[model samples]
Target: MSHPHSRRVRRGLIALAAVGGCALTTLVAVPASAAMTGSEKAADPASCPVAAEISQGYHDGHDGVDLAAPLGTPIFAAGPGTVTESGPASGYGQWIRIKHSDGAVTEYGHMNERFVNVGDTVTGGQRIASVGNEGQSTGPHLHFEVHRDGGTGFGDDPLAYMSERGVSLPCTP
Candidate 1:
């Protein structure tokens, strides 16, 4: 029989591949630029950006959607963007913040590892890091957020916004 560790590794690989496939499809379907709203038009999703609903729940501060996934599960870029910031910050443990060409910014926090460095261009659904429980978190999860350019304010609700665009999440608990 195969070793348990080996089996685990094999499963991890399969999971990674599945996640990658989804990201690739999301990138193609969204077409980065065409999916952009007024502000996003300048940036376009083409740079490869997409979001993953890691967990499930609700939070007022989070604008009412909670993504709950296992620790170390792959986290994908919501759309194509540049790694403008990738490091730890107050409240957010290991994190990566990407700036899309469309004057919008996406933040991924509670990361266990950062796969991409600052200044690197990342495509939507690309694996940027593993979900983690770094700072101010109760469990291993990712605190994802999006902000409009010039920091005017957050745009639409991330949960509804992503769903409206055709990205769907598995039922979470």
Candidate 2:
């Protein structure tokens, strides 16, 4: 036989579990993404660029992230910035670099076509290029990099940088 105190505790636990289940159901029914407005969608990093999988991530020698997409897939700017460099590059084929107002620089490489040119002011999520198997790449992908000091050196981990900015890389479709 259960004690009175134990019975009360058990009843309370059951009630809490029922309430939690209802809350969980409600949460599952309403996806956060579905509720986002146009402005919020624009600010969403997923909408910023490369809505594909990460073929390669930042590593010791690899200072950028590789987003795998089909050839001709459009690539968008990661943030609002001025195009400082755009055109053929040594190991990047067609490359585009944008210098943001915060002194941070974003680079996109291995593109088949560059829509933006040097000195062009680009907004976040603007189409800047398309994926291609150009230069040193083995397949079609966008090699994306973020430099904190806006220098032509090894960049910091792009995933971390995006995360710090409340952005996530390789957004899913």
Error of 2 at 144 (Å): 0.3
How well is each residue in 1-173 modelled by candidate 1, as lDDT tens digits? 74423422443455566777754333222224434455543335332122334454333345324455677777788778789889988887777888776666777777888899999998777889887888888887777665544233443345433443344443221
Score each candidate by Cα lDDT: 0.61, 0.76
Clashes of each: 25, 0
Which regions of candidate 2 deviate over 4 angstroms? 1-47
Error of 2 at 1 (Å): 75
Q: What's model 1's lDDT at 15?
A: 52
Q: For candidate 1, what is the TM-score?
A: 0.62
Task: Report the C-alpha lDDT of model 2 over 143-171, residue by residue, as the tens digit.
Answer: 99988657555687788667656677767
- Candidate 1, which segments miss by more than 4 Å at Cα? 1-43, 46-60, 63-65, 150-156, 169-173
Where does the lowest 10-residue lDDT sum fall in candidate 1?
Answer: 25-34
